[model samples]
Each structure stands twice: as C-alpha cells, then as structure tokens.
Target: MGKGPGLYSDIGKKARDLLYKDYQADHKFTVTTYTSNGVAITSTGIKKGELLLADVSTELKNNNITTNVKVDTKSTVSCRTI
Candidate 1:
C-alpha cells in the first residue's frame, strides 16, 4: 500500500475534535468588575504571560501540536511557559 498522511495525523485530528466539542459543551467565561469613585471598570486576568501560545496556523501546518507556546511578561521582564 502507498503511504498516506501518517499515524500521528489521525490521532491529532481526533484529539482536536474532542477538545473543540468539549469546549463548546461546557466552556464558560467568568466576568469581574472593579469600581473606584463611582466609576465602573472591568478587567480580567491581564497577566500577559498566562495566555496560551499555540499558533493554530503553525500547528495546522504540521498537523500536530507537540508543544506549548512560550511567552514573555513586561512586569518582571521574564519569559514564562504557557
């Protein structure tokens, strides 16, 4: 038989589909607000390094996501793994 995509391709696709479906099923966002001097303000986890860094385009290029994205923060001028 000829070579098709590969063994990992099938597994990766299944995992992605599973995660997407699960996210749609029960995923939610938590909202919080701040007020000072009668002025209302809103903020949510502004920590820069906390964001997931997986680039979907790049991951799709190889049809796999083998690693997490690395990120940097200005507060401490440090690099953090995401």
Candidate 2:
C-alpha cells in the first residue's frame, strides 16, 4: 500500500508491452506426467488455429507432431515436438 502499486499491479502492462507485443498467431501445447515407476512422459505440439470441429477429430492427428525429443534418457524421459 505504501508503494506505487503491488507486485502484480503492472502484470497487464507487462503482458501487453513485453509478452503479447512479440507474440505471433501460433498455437502450441505441451503435457508432462510421470508413470507409476517414475518414468516421465512429455509431449509438445502446435495446433492449427481457426478450424472447424471436424478438423480437430483425432487426439494427436490435429496436433501434427513434427518432431520429438527425448531428454535424460538414463534417468527420465522428456518429449518435445516442433
């Protein structure tokens, strides 16, 4: 209250000036999880924007996973798509 504003008061300004200013109309998504045995699974992909309901039929089909990446093969597994 003493200061000009709280920590989050300028978050909207930051988003508009710093974040969204450089953001393109690109769609992206990612998911990560651990198995019962501790093995990690992750996936990332880009999705098409402004499409009909029929276009998003499949789970990964619409995602259009172009590439996959694996990290920490010996300890954990991580996947990335671009």
Candidate 3:
C-alpha cells in the first residue's frame, strides 16, 4: 500500500495561491501543520533544491527580507518583497 500527498486546508490553499501570485516562482510551495508533544506549529515555503540551509539562508538574507514570525489563530498571509 502507498500513501498519496494530502490535500491542503482552506488556509493552506490560500497561502499557496498568494505565494505563487506574489513571487511568480515556478515551484509550488505547500504549507503543512502538525503537532509534536502537544505543541502546534505551522511551516510555509519550500526548501531550495540542492542548496544547504546555510546557503539558502545566506542567499535569502542577501536578496530577500529577513525572516519574521507572526502568531495568529486564523488564516492570514504575510509577505515581503524580494
């Protein structure tokens, strides 16, 4: 038996659409949420292929906005111009 890629929540679909509209990037990014030990967390964006985190971080720092974290219970989109 094999598993399939899951569907996105309403918020996740909106976020993905907004990212695509704003960034005009070719890759499709998906957001996922999960709980570990009763802690809820969310992750947006995708990792660069063949790039180390350090390398990607440095590149983002140089060309993109510094990372920011926002806490919200409802769905919202936060973005920065690259």
lDDT for model 2 = 0.48
In candidate 1, what residue range of length 10 has the lowest lDDT sum?
Answer: 53-62
Error of 2 at 25 (Å): 1.0
Candidate 2, superposed: residue stretches over 4 Å from native? 1-20, 48-82
For model 1, name the residue pairs that clash: none
Which residue pairs show backbone clashes in model 3?
A: none
Q: Summarize candidate 3's per-residue lDDT along 1-82 as a digit string, tens digits.
A: 8996776565488777877766743343445454443322444343466532211111123334544334332444343435
Query: Compared with the true structure, what per-residue lDDT tens digits does model 1 show for residues 1-82?
Result: 8978768657778778877855533322334443343322222233234352221111111233232222223232222222
Question: By the TM-score metric, which is better: model 1 or model 3?
Answer: 1
The best candidate in terms of TM-score: 2
Give lDDT per model, in order. 0.35, 0.48, 0.42
Name the weakest run of 10 consecutive residues (lDDT summed) in model 3: 52-61
- What is the descending TM-score order? 2, 1, 3
Q: What is the C-alpha lDDT profile of model 2 across 1-82, one tens digit per residue?
A: 4757557766688667785787677676667665554344565556457631111111221244443445432345444455
